[model samples]
Target chain A: MRIIRYSEAINEALHQLLASNKKVFLIGQGVTSPWYVGTTTVGLIDRFGPHRVFDTPVSENAVTGLGVGAALTGMRPIVVHPRMDFMYYAMDQIANQAANWHYMFGGQMSVPITIWGIINRGGEQGAQHSQALQAIFAHIPGLKVVMPSTPYDVKGLLVASVEDDNPVIFIDDRWLYNYEGDVPEELYSIKIGKGIVRRKGKDVTIVATSYMVYKAIEAGKDLEKEGVDVEIIDLRTVKPMDKQLLYNSVKKTKRLVIADASWKTCGIGAEISATIAESKLLTTLKAPIIRITLPDAPAPASSVLEQAYYPESKDIVLAVENLLKYSCDNNEKCDY
Target chain B: MYKKKSVNTDIPLKTLREMYLTMLRIRKFEETVASLILKKEIQTPCHLYIGQEAIATGVCTSLRKSDYVFSTHRSHGHYIAKGGDLKKLMAELYCRETGCSYGRGGSMHIADPDIGLPGSSAIVAGTIPLAVGVAYSFFLQKKDNVSVAFFGDGAVGEGVFYESLNLAALKKLPVLFVCENNLFSTHMPISACLANIDIKKTAETFCIPTARVDGNDVQSVYKTAKKMIENARKNKGPAFIECMTYRWYGHVGPNLDIDKGLRSKEELDYWMKRDPIKKLERQMIQQKILTIAKKKVIEEMIKKEIDEAIAFKNKSHSPEKIDIARSVFKEE
Candidate 1:
């Protein structure tokens, strides 16, 4: 294993794919410029040549559809949408064409296209640039939505997505880019619809995704010091969720708290909450589930307001503490 | 001004007959669809390719079976001309299990990647970028395959059209953008939509080579498409062809759309004078290469094919419920 930042891990994965496969190519607005896509696409053009690593114009919809077209014609294309929020411009291609092309053509064709969308949260980026629109993508039936938090999973999931025989939406949050983690030097893949337990305990279950996984881990540390053990499940893939892992974890700890970066209403948190509720765990619930998410509104631009807009470790801690407090109160009063 | 090519004496007679037969087949297939819809044999909304058959036939004839074509909602002509299975296309419109898309994509999303027609879409200006991508793939592979995007004049108003043109030119990819300028966008005429209606000018502004031809004249469309496609395969970059044409049927369904007061009968009659099939027949007769008996024989053969396709569609079954869950991904 090699220690690397999340961005470098992704860069290594792409570099490996380009070097190993002649059929693979990269297309995006600033694939050659590190300033736009950062170190993730650095030195790609220099290594693989121009025909493979192409820097394109600011035509998101067309570029995305171009990626789909290339993928359809026996090419593995990793098309980058530098900002996840702006990807809505290319939603028609992503949702309608890329997602539905295989199914629409009776499964005779497959789009081996990996659409990489980066989530830029905070930085005074305002409403347009800061959205984590994973829910919008997850809602689409034909799309496979994956959100990788760690440096290792970032490389693994991206490779898995590229190898998958369908159009996969690989979403990454930039807030997790600079963070360091131990990633493998050899090429490997983590399955698309799997999750892992970051820190396991029995007091309460904390299911978090994307960058929110880091915040939930921090919250788990705080609770650990407070004698309340918190279990953290880093949900790597949002769409084909690891339901069995989550259900079994929830079965062990009846109290649940979900942390997500998207809107509170109709978000992944709500989906998880609903999934747990519909399962056999509903009868064993000690208290109502809590969700730590952004307020249901556009992100404010002000630094202070932005602080309030995004949920942090304190918010996760508070949600978990509140759920524990309610359960503890019920146990103390013998209110079974 | 676009220079019109004269009837070159160099081309083979068999090729000319094949192109003529393709246009007639499109006409007959659409006519069969019209009667099927009228008789309630098929239920999905269909945008026919009656008068505009020449453009599709001409453009597709210029392409190799290895080349790709991404088409619009009015795609029956494109599907047939590009060598898509007539039986599968008819079954698709009928929403049967044996359909090309297995009833998932009614008339709009017909596709046959085996024959280089990857797919078509109902959304206006949808497949334009897909074509550019296909061309980009050829550029990456360093191959000679050309990709074509066929859309109506109304689709030119879409932002994607300009974006696709810009990218295709900037990259100098092997792509051909064919805008069938049928003079109308649903109910509104093109004049009402765009302040300046020079369709080729926008593409030319992007430094891409542009051509405007009489869409109803099969020879003119065929000549321009072949040249541009050849230029694209030689890595001369992308080219845009604007074909002046008309849709005989309404924007959708079996009836004529002119009764909605969007267009006058006089305009329709004027365009009908430039009928592509008649123009091809006149040329063939003038050259004394094809007699009326031969033309009738060709028409009869096409009718039999259309009749067999309709029968196949009628006999096929609807997909079972489990099939719906299957095609969502490859793993299924």
Candidate 2:
């Protein structure tokens, strides 16, 4: 195992995929430049000539369409968008063309393409740059949405995304890029549509994604000190979400809290909460399904206001502590 | 009798006849589709390629099975000319299970990967950059296959089209940009919409070899397409062909007057005189290349084929609701 930052892990995964597969190439604006916003594609152009690592003009719609076209014709194109907000410009290509091509063509064609973007509420970037739109993409049926938090998870999930035959939106939180974790030096890939239990416990199930996974882990550590055991499930892929795993966990723990960095309205947290409510686990709840999410307003430009806009470890811990207190006070053999 | 130009005598009479037949097939198919729309049998908005058959047939003639082709709203002709199965295409139009897109993609979105026709988009100027990307793939693989993009004069106004053309020319990739200049985009005429109506001149601005042809003349379209295609195959870079054609029907559906009238009766009549299928039939008869009896036999054969296609489409099932979640992400 080697310690590396989240961005370096993605870079290593890309390097391995490119070195192994001759058909794999990179495309997008600033992808070939060392000053890539995420710094995930640094030194890629030097290793693999300019042809393999192309820098497209700032035509998001056209470039994304080009990536789809290339992928259909048997090239694995990794398109990098600097920020997730700019993806709206190419939504037609992503949602209409890339996602629907396979099903629309009756499985006659497959787009082995990956669209990577730096997401989450970055400091002082204002409303445009600092927003997590994973739920919006998750609403689309044809796309696979992956948001990996740790360096290990990023490396493994990215390698799998590149090799997969579908169009994947691999989201990287800008704030999590510098966060370091132990990653395997050998090439490996994590299975798509599977959630991992970061910390296994028996009392409550805390579901989180992207940067919120780390916050959940931190919250779980605090809960452990008070003898309130927590099971943390990191949902790497949000679209083909590991529904079975979530259901099984909810059934076991009976209580649930979702820590999502995105807004509350129709977010992935809402979907998970709904899924739990629809499942047999609804009878097993000890308290109402709790969600620690960002405010429904646009991210503020001020650093202090932006901090309040995003959910943090303290927010997640407080929500969990409240649930634990309610369970203890009502002690009727806690159904949830 | 019109004299047949033998610019490339090496191209066999049989090859020319085949090109003519392909164009006729598209023309007849569109006519049948139009009648179906008029009778209310087909429900979707149909963009008839009645007058622009030669452009599709001509460019598709030069493409191999390995080559990729992208098309636009006026795409039935391109799809059929590029070897798409008539039965599947009919099924798609009928919104049946046997459709190329399994009834999910209607009139404007028929795609058959087996024949190298990926798909067509309803959005104007959408397929230009896609074709360029496909060509770029061929360049990367060091393959001789060229990608063909079929669009209308309206596409020139789109920024993506200009960006794609610039990139294709800069990369010197194997691409054939076929502009079927039908003089109008929907109700607006090219002259009214564009500053420069000359598509070939616009292509020349990017240093791409440009050719202008009478789109009604199938032979002229075929000859120019062959030259441009050969040039691309030799890695001589991209070439642009502008076929000055006209759409017989209105922009959408069979009704000619459903929308606002843009073309005069005199203009329509003058263009009808140069009908591509009728012109080819006349040439074949005058030259004794195809006897009247033989022409009847060919018509009967095509009619039978179309009838069988309609029957197959009628028998095909509609898509299941459970299939909605499938194929979004490719399973390994």
Candidate 3:
């Protein structure tokens, strides 16, 4: 195992895919520019030549349609969106065309394309430049969304997405780029819709996605010093979520807190909370479910405002402490 | 001004007969669909290719079986011309299990990738960039295959149209953009939409070779499409051909728009006098290629085909309730 940054893991995965398969090619606005896509696309153009690693003009919708079109003709294409916010311009091609092609055609055709959308938040990028809009793509039926947090999962999930015989939305956060983790050099894939327990405990169950997984782990350590045990589950894939795993963890802990780097309403947290509510697990919960997410407003640019706008590990600790306080104050029997 | 090509003594008699047969099939199939819509047999909205048969027949004739053709909401003519199964298309319109799309796609969404017609969509300019992508695939593979995008004049208003053109030109990919300029975008005239109604000139701005032809004249459209498609197959970049035609029916169903006051009767008559099928029939007869008896025999053959397709549609079953969620994702 080699310790590699999250962005390097992604770059290595693309390199292996292109080398292994001649049908795989990369296309987007700034694939050649590291400043736009980070080091994830580094050295791709030099190794594969220009035909395979194509840097396209700034035509988001057309470029996306180009990917879908090539997929129709049996080419595996990876179309990258430098910023997740501007991907809305390609909504018709993504939602109406790529999402519905397989189903509408009665499974006669398979669109084996990967849409790589990088989430850029903070750095005072403002609302348009900074967004984690996985919820929007996750809402569509035919699309499969995966948000890998660690370096290991990032490389594995990307390979799985490219090989899968459907359009997979691979979302990543720029904040997680520099973080390093152990990744196998060999090409392998982690099963989608599977979650892993980052840190195991029995007090409170924390379900975090993508970048928030690290924050949740940080909070878990801080809570450990205060004698509050926290269990963190890294939800690798969001669409076909591992409901069984979540149910078992929540059943053990009897307390649940969902941390996602998106807005609160109709977000991934809401989906998970609603799923638990509908399941038999509703009876297993000891307190109301809490969600740590961005407030219901656009992200601001000011440094002070940015500090308050985004949630951190401290917020998770506070939420867990508040839940424990409510449990002890209201009930005669307190597990904590 | 677009130069009009004269009737060449070069086209084979058999090819002329085949083009005539294709146009008649489209006209008769749409006419049958009009009656079917009135009879409440087809429940989905259909954009009929009534008077615009020549463009599809002419362009498709120039293409090989391996060449890809992406079409628009008005797609029956393109499908039939590209050798899509008539019974399957009819079954799809009726939303039957044995349909081409297994009842999932109606008139607006039809596909047959086996014959290089990957798919068609209702969204204007939806499949334009897709054709360019397919062309790019061929270019990357060093193949001589060409991809054609058949859209209406309304699609020219979309930004992706120019974007696709620019990409095709930038890559020098082999693609043909066929614009069936039928003079109306739904109920509005092209004049109301485009400040500059020159569709070919718009494509020319991308440095692509452009051609304008009379869509009612099958010979003109065929000659132009063949030249452009041949040029594309040589990997000489993309070409655009704007075929001037008109639709007899309304934007969607069977009813003519004349009663709705969307178009004047005088304008409709002017195009009606230039009916592609009638014009081809006249040319074929004057050339002693089609006698009245032969024409009657051909008409009966097409009528029987449409009848058999309708019967197949009536006999097929609807998709089962248990399989409602099937095919949403390709089962691995």
Candidate 4:
């Protein structure tokens, strides 16, 4: 195993996908430009040529529909929107066409398109450019949403999305691109709706999505030094969530803190919290669940406003400590 | 305006008869659909194809069975013309499990991929880009097949329509864009909707070959569509045909809209005089290729087919509640 950047892992997955299947082609705006989609699409045009690496015009709706159509015709196409916020232009094709085609037309056809969207935050980008819309896509029934935080998961998830016989929304965060992890050379696919236990503990359970997984781990380490045990779960797929994993973890810890990289109102955290509240594990909770997420407002342009806008590992740490404090106050068996 | 090229005497009488048969089939099918809707037997909101049969019949008659066709909301004619199974389409309108879409999609989303029609979208201009992508796949696979997208003037307002045209011409993909300019987007007239009335000129701006024809005349539509379809198959790039036609019913359902004051009866009568079926029926009669008695026999045969389709629908089962979530994704 070799340590590689998350972006490099994505590049390798594209290379393997193209080589393995002649029908697989990458189409989107600025696919040929290394700067446009970051290093993930580097040297793709040179290696695969312009045909397989189709750099399309700035037509989000049509390009996304083209991916759906190509998939219908038995070709695997990955349509990319460099910015996740701009996918709104293609919501008709994504939500109405690609997502509905399989179910609408019965099982007669399959639209195996991987709609890859990148989440860009910070850098003074205003509300329009900075967004994490995985929750909106996760709400759609026909689509499967995957957000991988680690380099290893990114490569495996991308491979799995391309190979799946359904539309998959692969949302990646640019903030986690520089993170390095050991990745295998051979191509592999991670299951779509499964989650991973990043770190094991006996205290509060922290359920995190995408880049928040890294933040959760950071919070876990800090909590450990402060004499509070913490368990972190990386929710790789947003939709079709690993509810069993979360339920089992919560059943043991009897306390929960959800950290998500989106708005507070009806976000991934809300969904996870509701799931735990509805299940039989609701009886095991010693304290009320806490959600660490961005405030119910748009991302600000100023660096100072952005700091308060985005919830970090410290927010997770605070939520966990508060939960433990409450649990200890209510239950005599609690040890902090 | 391109001169009406005489229907080549060389195109065999059998092919010409088949063209007439397709148009007749569509007209009869839609007439029955309207009656069914009035009787409340068919619940789907069907966009009738009574007055626009020529374009679909003409274009589809020239297409191979393997050539793909993407259609819009008003698409019963396109499906029938493309050799779609009548029973499945009827079942779809009836919302039965035996439907083309397995009772999931109603009249607006009819599809038969087995006959090269992957699907039809209710959204304006939604299927345009899909057709272009299908053509691109054919080009990439070195297949000689061509894809046709049948949409109304309403789709031109959508941004994706031009995007599809740009990509199709840029790649020299094998596709035909058939604009059935029926002069209305729902209730708004095209004259009021479009800034420039020349739809063909828009295609010409993309540097794709363009043609405008009398859509009511099946021969003109068939001839122009044949030339364009052949050019696409030869890999000469995409082509556009603007078929000036009209829908007899209001935007949807069986309403003529005359009593509703949406459109004038005089206007309806004017277009009715140019009825595609009667125009083709007269031409065949004058050419001595068909007789009045023979035409009656053809009508009888079509009526029997429609009856059989209805019988099939009657026997078909409605979707069960247990299978409600099935086919949401491809099952492994």
Candidate 5:
């Protein structure tokens, strides 16, 4: 295993994919530039040449459609949307064309394409720049949405996405690019719809994704001191969620708290909460499910307020503590 | 203006007959669709290609089955000319389950991948970039196939058109951008809307070889399309062809009313004198290659085929409401 930053891990996966497959190519704005905003695509053009790793005009919609068209014609295209917020401009191409081409064509075509968007609640980047809209894409039926919180998972999941026959929306949190984790040195891939158990406990199950996964791990460590053991599930793939793993964990613990960085309303947290409620686990719950997410509003511009707006380890812990207090006050016992 | 070049009388009579058959098919299909719309049988807005059949027929005749073609909103002529099944197209327009797109795509989005006519988008200039991408794929695969994007003069103002042209030229991809300059974009004339009405000059700015032809003349349009497609197949890169044409009906449906008073009666009469279908028939008769009785027999045969297609569409089922959510994603 090699310790590397999340961005480096992604770069390694891309380089490996390109080296292995001659049909694979990359296109996006500023992709061939020296500055490389995310630093994940560095040295790609130098190695692959401009024909394969090239820069497209600022026309996001056209470029995205071009990627989809190329993918349909037997090419594996990896399109980079510099910032996730700018994806709105190309939503028609992504949602209507790339996502629906295969099924719409009666399974006669396959779009082996990967769209990587740098997203997260970036500090001080006001309302427009700092949106975690993974839930919006997850709601779409034809798309595969994945967000990896660790460098190891990023590399494995990215390789899997590139190899997948369907279009995969691989979102990378800008805040996690510099975060370091141990990744394998050999070529490997993680399954598309599996979750990793970060920490195992019996009291409460905390399901998290992306940046929230890190916070959940930290909160699990802190809660161990108070004897409130927590089971943390890092949901790597948001769309084809690991419902079996989550349901099994929740069935055992009989308590749940979801931590997501996106807005609370209609968010992934809400979907997970609803899923648990609608399942047989509803009767097994000792207390109502809790969700810790960003406030229901555009992220504020102020740095201090922005920090307050995003969910953190403290928020997860507080939500867990509240659920526990409610169970105790109601004289309920954990039942499975 | 340059002197009119003598007609290529040496071309085989069989090729001219095929072109005539294609145009007649498109014209008959549009007429049938217009009648259906008027009878309240087909509900969707129908864009008739009554006068512009020559453009679709002539351009598509030069393309191969492996080559790709993209079309705009006024796409019925394109669909039929590109060898789309009349029964399936009629079924699609009627929202039948057996339609080309399973009734999901109506008149504006008829697509048949088996013949390499992937699909037509309602968005103006939307398929320009897509055509370039398809051309790029052929280039990457080292194939001789060329991709054609058919749009109208209205699409020239779209930024995507310019961007796609530049990219195709820079990459030297095998693409033929066919602009059917039908003089109007949904009732607005080109002169009133565009600052520069010259499409060939604009294409030349991107260093792409270009040609301008009378879209109403089937032979002229077919010859130009043939040359451009041949050049592209030879790895000579992209070319742009501006086919000057006109739509005989309203922008959306079958109506003779010329809105905005942009088209004069005299101009319409002058173009009618150069009707492609009549011109081809006259040439065929004068050369003693086709008799009037033979032409009648061909028309009657086409009418019967169209009637059977209409019956097939009428008997087809409508898509179920539950199937709406099925084709949005690939499950496996």
Candidate 6:
């Protein structure tokens, strides 16, 4: 395996797609600028020229719709939203047009477009810039949402999303960009709607998405010294969610804890909790399920409030401990 | 078997008659929809194309089947004028499985890619960039096809309209922006909405060539659209056409809403006197091209066609319960 950073892996995926396919092009507000998109599209224009790499105006709605139109006309377009918060302006094109085209057209047409939104949380970017809105796209039908934690998954998933025949929301977080992991040199595609076990254990199963998976792994390592064998599962793709993988993990461990970098209400964690409750997976639970997510409030600009507004690795560790205590409380068995 | 002639819009007598017949078809189709909605047969928000037939037919005549036209909610005129199937469009409004979108999208979201009518979005100014993107693809692929975006005067106030105009001009993509200036944005007059109602001037700021036409006069609109389309095909960038017309019915439903206090009977009557079909009819008859009896025959034929479409929609079955969640993506 070859070693690569999360940032370069995405660039490699785009490079391979653009080099191999003539119909594949990039469009967004800051695609070619490395500083804006963080080297994801560096030197792409020099190689493929302007026809393939488009640096558009500050019109988010029109730019997104333009990508939709291009996708409908037999071109694969990867649209970048540097800061995902601004993507709210293009919700009409994303939800109404890109997500509804195939369904509205009776399956006769497909919008082969990939919307790559970068999450820029922390650094006191305030409420407008530092927000993880993957849950919003995950809630919409006709959209496949993917969030990769490792370099291998990010590169493979980006290629898979670009090759997919429907609109895919590929969300990446800046916190994980410099993080390095083993990746293969050749191009490949990871299967969507699948999750993998990051660290296997017999006790509580920790399910996480995107950068939260890295947080879960860190929490799991710390908890292991105290005899807490936490199983960590990285949910590579969220929307057509890896339901079977989640079910298998929860059934095996008999306890579940979901950690996410999104808000509490109507977030990915809430959806997963609902899925378990709806599917009667609660019957197999030894204790009540725990979800570690940010409180339902706007992100504060102050550093202290920002820390409280966001969920971190320590929060995952606390949630796992709470689950263990709840299990003991239910049985009145032992002291921690 | 029935393909529109677009090589040269010198517009022969036969093609002119064809355009006239096409306009009459759109008029009869929307009128049938209105009647059905009144009778509770068609259960959807029906936007009638009673007075603005010339705008769609004239602009669409200059486009080939390979050319794309993205439309707005008031879109039956553009869709039918671009040769969208009458039966499929009717079934879509009827919410039948045989509809254009298989009962998924109703009247506002009718789409059929076979004739290059990719979609009609209900949101105003939503599909403008989509049209530009289609042109971008055509330009990149080096295809001699132009994409048309048919929006109303309301969409001119939308930011995407200006953005689309700028990008299409900057890239010199083959796009023709058609604005059906019906003078109202959902009951608000153009005077109330914008400081300057000369919409083409906004496009000219982007250095794209512009044209203002008498929408009721189909011949003038046809000539202007043909030249712009040809210019885009020759890689001369985009063009704008502000067709001065009026929607006879209210903004939402099928009624002359003069009592709403937004428009006056005088304003309505002044535009109604410039009725596009009658204007073309007068020209055709004066040139000894179409007789009164022939006009009656064409009207009867289009009425029969509408009746057949309604019958087909009636006979069509509804989607099953299991099919409700399908087509969220292309089959797997």
Candidate 1 positional error at A44, Å: 1.2
For model 4, what is the error of residue B192's alpha carbon versus the real structure, in angstroms, after optimal superposition? Answer: 1.3
> Could you estimate the TM-score for every candidate?
0.97, 0.93, 0.97, 0.97, 0.91, 0.96
Higher-ranked by DockQ: 3 or 4:
3
- Model 5 lDDT per residue over A1-336, tens place: 779999899889988988899888888888888665477889998999887887887777777777777887878888898788888887877887777666554455678889988774556889888888898888876899999999999999999888888999999898898899899988799999899899999999999999889999999988998899999999999988999999999999999999888888999999999999889999999888888888899989999898788888988888888789878865454321
Model with the higher TM-score, candidate 1 or 2:
1
Error of 6 at B114 (Å): 0.6
Q: lDDT per residue, candidate 2, A1-336, as tens digits? A: 879998899889888888999889888888877766567888888999877888877778878887888899889988888888889988878888788888776777888889987784656889998878899999997889999988998999888888889899999898898999899987899998999999998888999999999999988888788888999999998978999989878888888999888889999999999999988888888888889888899989999887788888888778877777677777454443
- For model 1, residues B32-149, the per-residue Cα lDDT tens digits are 8999899988798899999998899989999999999999889899999999889999999988889988888889989988899999988899899999999999998899999999
> What digit string (tens of lDDT, one per residue) describes model 3 on residues A1-336?
989999999999999999999999999978888777997899998899888999999888899999999999889999999898879988888999999999887889988889999988899989998899988899998999999999999999999998888999999999999999999999999988899999999999999999999999999999999999988999999988999989989999989999999999999999999999999989978788899999999999987999998999999998888777766667444323
Better of 4 and 6 by lDDT: 4
Clashing pairs in 5: none
Clashing pairs in 6: none
Query: In candidate 2, residue B117 scores what lDDT?
Result: 94
Q: What is the Cα-based lDDT of residue A323 in candidate 4?
A: 85
lDDT (Cα, tens digit) per residue for candidate 6, span B83-130? 988999899889899998798888888888989999989889999999
- State chain A's TM-score for model 2: 0.95
Question: Candidate 6: misplaced stretches above 4 Å?
Answer: A330-336, B1-10
Q: Compute the interface RMSD for each candidate structure.
A: 1.3, 1.5, 0.7, 0.8, 2.2, 1.0
Q: What are the fnat scores of the candidates, in the order listed?
A: 0.74, 0.57, 0.76, 0.73, 0.37, 0.81
What lDDT is obtained when candidate 5 is compared to the true structure?
Answer: 0.85
Cα lDDT of model 2 by residue, B1-332, tens digit: 75554343445677777886788788778889999998999997789999888788878887898899998888899999999899998999998878988887889888988899998888888878788889888988888889998999999888778878887887798889988898887888889999988778988999889989999877788888888888888999999998998888888998665235577877888888888888877877776777888877877878887999899998899888888666655676
Name the runs in model 3 displaced over 4 angstroms.
Answer: A329-336, B1-7
TM-score of 2: 0.93
Report lDDT (Cα) of residue B244, candidate 6: 91
Residues forming the 10-long window of minimal summed lDDT in candidate 6 chain A = A327-336
Which DockQ value does candidate 1 get?
0.70
